[model samples]
Target: AQASFSQVFMGVAFTCGAEEEVIPFFDRGLPVEYELTRSIRVVAKTNRKKIGVLNTEAKLFGGFDFQSMRSTPPWPVVDELKKQYDVEQVSASEPIEEEYDALLIALPSSLPQKEMDHLQDYMEAGNPTLLLVDPLTIINVGLSPSEKAGANMNPFMRNQGPPPKEKGDIHALMTALGVSWNKAQIIWDQYNPHPDFAHLQPEIVFVGANNPEAFNQEHTASAGLQELVLLFPGSLRKAADSDYDFQPLVKTTPASGSLNYSQLVQRSFFGVQLVQPRFGHRPNPAAYTMAAHIKGESFPDTTNGADSDTTQTPTRVNAMVIADLDFISQQFFQIRQQAVGNLNFDNVTFFLNCMDVLVGDESFITLRKKRVRHRTLETIEEKKREFREEQLKEEQEAEAEASQALAEAQKRLSEKVAEVRQRTDLDDRTKEIMARNLQEAEQRKLDALKNKIEAKKEARIQRSKEEMEAKIRSIQSNIKVYSVFLPPLPVLGFGIFIFVRRYKREKEGAAAARRLRA
Candidate 1:
């Protein structure tokens, strides 16, 4: 039995890449022979893509560290990236090496001109990069000393303002990519919100990929992501003459608009911070881009030896710019952590996916993509909303008119009864009975009128509902008929036509042959 099983296994193994096979039998059995084929060698994967982190010492605006804390492990995101790729901390002063697949600049407080030139050179060479920056720099000051030094002198005060241009190349790079970032304006959304941070209003906006107006579903970076929470995120607008193909990855809802954070902040007597509303004109509400993917030619290649004059070669450049950096901060991730469940937000996944795409490591994207359970329904049309409002108004007016008519009928009936009671010819009992009968008739009339009004209202409502249902059914029926029967009709008609033509041709041919023979 063992020999038989081995023979069957060998037959199957021969079709596969399996190599040498050895079959052993009991010592008492005769020598057993098994076919020996060439052994297959397995090669281990060792070449991991290199990811260079640029400007690790740059102070984050919100007093958050880009690297890990002293005692705690490095930011989970950093550690996660290290697992898949070779991560290295590189300084801005040094030239980015060709070995590095991509560069990451996370919440840098400043970028010197030398470093900017290096980055420009790197990107212009057809390399990809990720820029995670905040438009406004956050400063916490509890005393006068804190204001002078620009450092966190006091831990009690919270002051935020626009960062100086010298701090980083956010504006320059954004302009190059055809995106304009306004540090003074903060994006807010009243519709989609986070539960814990509801009091912060628009300062903390929750955007999901399923929102068609807010997220670009066509882009792979934002495709399957569920939700991302932006903390004091700045607004991103497209430049009119941008040469790159700008695709918005994340955006605020239609309820969002730019609010001046400087004017909105006010300190209360108890030292509590308050966001005061603007008294006069308000900014128009619209969707604003939070993150975008820009792809285009880096620059005109002018150094191809003698061919440089005749033909200009431009390398394709790809870069992703996010208006806010705090979304992926360790502090924000900790705050968003759930006590009992998988993480609620997809910030980490989004960051990783962006990095992967920038570095041309799209194979990692499939592992991070998740199906979100919470989905927002599609919005209704403005015309439909207006029609509903009109229907309600007409119903209210009808009710008021019915009530007035009933009151007038009752008043007239009462007057008639009183006049009949004043008649002198009628006896006392007769007069009493007549008045009672008149009162009963008035009550019946009132009840009938109420019934009639109710019936009419109900009928109208039912008719409207039926009409709507019928319209829906008609649309569904048309779709079904077209899908099931419309496609085959042409084919069926063609087949019948071919058969008829063939039959006619055969009959004619037979008649012609018989006549010729005759």
Candidate 2:
């Protein structure tokens, strides 16, 4: 069965690569092969550790594919972690092994509150648990009759509860970890002026804040993460009463935003606007709080179970929350191609980065490349950054080379001057004549050295001037390139996209008619 599956996989892989350029494929493929080999070696070094992945089943999630639900899988990193660590996926319905070192909970909010309650003991016993709070809804027993309308509303109502009080009871557990979900908040970036998003909508960019004691550089998961993507609108913030330190992972823009529950579910009649925009009537430019981390004193178990006698321990827990649910929707990924500044997959990368941190792997962060648009202004900025880096390197090399050259020249001149001074076999008059000639030669040598020094300085100065001129020229050229295409590059890309789409559809129809006739 394994051999058969491998064959099929190889076939699919080859078919996908069939149309790719052969030279490019080999160039890219060779390096990837070596990377995989190195990764395998690293895994071999680790003692197998168990990593529990808690997710909702299809029945509970309305036929959702639990394994395939995430915007990006944490499996790659988890598998790597397993090489040094044992990895396992625990279902919401399954019992957790007491021997497991770390637990990762990635499930919808509709999970039973009892499960979270059950895990409280393990959490308090110093085991690490990573929680991913689904976009908005959470699992709770406080669900009302109207809230449990169907599969669609069941989790939302069950987890989030009713109006007026937006924050859920999940805060009770999160409080132990010094983290609580900010149910009403949303991250929005008001500074987006890209042509596609300008008239359509404002993109949301979240920010992270540090909490010193709980989240220092020691923990691999929280290491080097500046910001996390807002998968949901709601966020996590530090609680007042908890002893553990809390740190922000995702944040909102400083655009006069709010966590008003009324605005989130505005009821509209006809075409009149109902709720005011969250950023208000004007614009602002600061980052707001969203996701957070807690690294100490997770919980105290007050359970009636048989394991109630287990000694209390100060455990660590990491949790992330995003308010908006639609951020992870397939529609968002599909429509992203139409956005300006080549904004496609920005959010996707953010999600993968979060998973990488949680799984303690740096590969995802290192492997991904930042997309650069072909716009003139953007190109100028790119060139400037590249040129500055090259210039600094060249300057360092030139300085070292100049110093070495000066040392060599000085050594030779000193030796020559000493040799000339030693000639005393001639008569006084001859000696004097030879002395004057030697003096003239020595002076010439000194002059040459001085000129060389000055030349090096001038060369450096000239290089700087050239660089400045080049930067200015690049900026002007970029302006001209974009100006030739009036409004923006996104508009041009969109027009071309539409034209190609229409042409493909027409060709497909003609081909189908021909096949039918044949």
Among the numbered candidates, top lDDT falls to: 1
lDDT per residue as tens, model 1, 174-198: 5755677765566666444333453
Q: lDDT of candidate 1 vs native?
A: 0.60
Q: What is the TM-score of each candidate against the true structure?
A: 0.53, 0.46
Candidate 2 lDDT tens digits, 1-518: 45543422121121122221111122211224433443454444444346665654213222332223434333333433443445665664444555665565543344556665666545655565666553333221122111222233322243454422222245566566576655444334432323243343333443332212212244343444432334325545667767776666445544424444334334322111223343222223344454455666545545656365677654655444333433444444443434533334444444444555555565545443223433335555455545544554555466666667778776777666566556677666775676578667866876788678758855984686488557858777778877888777888899999999999999999999999999
Worst 10 residues of 2 by lDDT: 138-147
Candidate no. 2 TM-score: 0.46
Best by TM-score: 1
Assess the local accuracy of residue 14 in candidate 1 as a C-alpha lDDT between 0 and 100: 22
lDDT of 1 at 453: 74
- Kindly report which residue pairs in candidate 1 clash with one another: 110-167
Residue 306 accuracy (lDDT) in model 1: 52
